[model samples]
Target: MGRMGRIIISVIVILGLLALGLKGCSTTLRKAVFAKAMPGSYFAEYSRIHPSLYQVSGQVYAFEKEFARSMILRTPDGIAVFDTFDTAHMISLKQTLEQEWPQESVRWIVLSHNHLDHIRGSDVYPKAEVIGHKDINQLVADWPNVNSDIASVTREISDDQTLTFGDVTVEALYMPFSHSSTIYGFHIPSDNVVFAPDMMFVDAVPPFGFPDFYYPGYIRALDRLIAVNAEHYIPSHMDRGTRADLIAFRDMTVEFQGVVEDEYLKIDPEDFIQGIGMGDAIKSAYDRLHPKYGHLHGFDAMFVPKFGRHFGGTYLGY
Candidate 1:
């Protein structure tokens, strides 16, 4: 064969290899996108026990109680428990701890927020030092007819702080006005897990309108959580979640917010109430996003009335 013929054969071989490589790359990308879009339901094996315990990582375990969840970290120093539920639930958790790991002592009690449901059982762990955001004290002080002793017990934390015990490090990040002004999230670097209470919901949609939530701040908090890049993301209310779950929730929230804002902008503020009542405005937003998010739990029944209407009103200044 001539020199030119050999060169042409070499070029053809290179082209064939390039096409094969591109085919493999395309297949991998498609699989990744499909997995992200259709994540498996993590709540399929959700525990029903009052205070069920599941190991989330080597030294980290999750204590779940129906809708409320907490984290238990076992370190060389001792054990750190986060967010004790109501009094009765706390008792059950304590009993479980005693039964399973009698040698382990509760050295620290961490609060995700000052919400009553999350902090009511703090008193149960008498020996443990309670930790929470500094604003938690002020929230307790403002409450009427409630015991002020909680403020006295809590050791306030700043915007960002870390508690180290042996090889384990737990970082608490304060996210103001996310769920509430006093909320914070806990990140455990060793376990690659983040405990975010009320910051994001997994396997379910938020009620119609996020009552008492600062919408923009909530989105920011969610963004912050995603940036942590944790392997497992656990929300207080529901099951164990992955990074994909959090991203999905964030995308849905941003989409829903856009729908509400777009609808509100189309209407004049002066005739807002007269043109479309709060309920109708909420319905409009819900209708727009339903096809994309209709599969989420509470999309039709709870989310529209409880969260959507309130969210629309906030945007419309109603």
Candidate 2:
């Protein structure tokens, strides 16, 4: 072989290597673009503003609007609503309902929990029978300033109440200490879907600002929901999920708790919040978990500060 032959071979090898590198870079860019397109990212805010209706299965429909979601089940008798959005959006929701199901009246309004966002619009459905956990009456009674007419007609449901409307059977199970002490989950046997509010946010980490979390009970509730083996799961705030997503969420929660607890143990219990500092502790825990969960939406900008304060406060008994 001559020197010219060797030079040509070297050039070919370099070009081949460059092609492979470009291909790898392109693949990575595509992945990053897809991740941003998914829920919980910046794109979510735009997608959430416009109310969208999705048919889960048969007569069951999921209505999502700007970080809040609700479900509707239609039967020959009437329509049953899982949760009404905030009171301000009640008019739009009502209009959508009327346009979608003109003849059917909303006969039942079921509250997933006592949270104002999920229940404040109950009065919009005047003729509907409002159903909720017995604790909701007290929650409403405590808030006399809020003009909620649903409280007056709200019927208390037992822990294991099953509501049957035609072919649909919705089982409302009491899941205490998960999101709130009074929170409950709705299981639809026909659709094989479970609607659990505020317990899990699909495709995204839980929000940072709201800190009402009972770690132990939240794990137990997730375990129970997973055991149900539903084909589809609907959370209050985000997109629909699957059993795998629930498992992922549970695993993430357990892993995060372990990391935070381990870090918290490093500092003196008396000085955990003050001396070590809440922000520093949170950043430390986040740094350890970032290798695994850094890709999750809100891990950096939203979750770190809120999780730090909440976990630090819990550790310090504040």
lDDT score for candidate 2 against the true structure:
0.72
**Candidate 1 accuracy as TM-score:** 0.78
Against the true structure, what is each candidate's TM-score? 0.78, 0.78
After superposing candidate 1 on the true structure, give the runs of residues whose Cα lies further than 4 Å from its correct spot. 1-50, 144-152, 273-280, 306-318
Write model 1 residue lDDT over 1-318, tens digit each, in one string. Answer: 346844754464455445445765577655544443232332332445356888998898988876678888988788888887677767888888899899989888888887766777778878888888877767766675764224234578778888775568888888876787788888998889988888767757764355657777888999999999988888787656788888898898788777777766677777775755555666687678867887776564345344455455556553
TM-score of 2: 0.78
Compared with the true structure, the alpha-carbon lDDT of candidate 1 equals 0.72
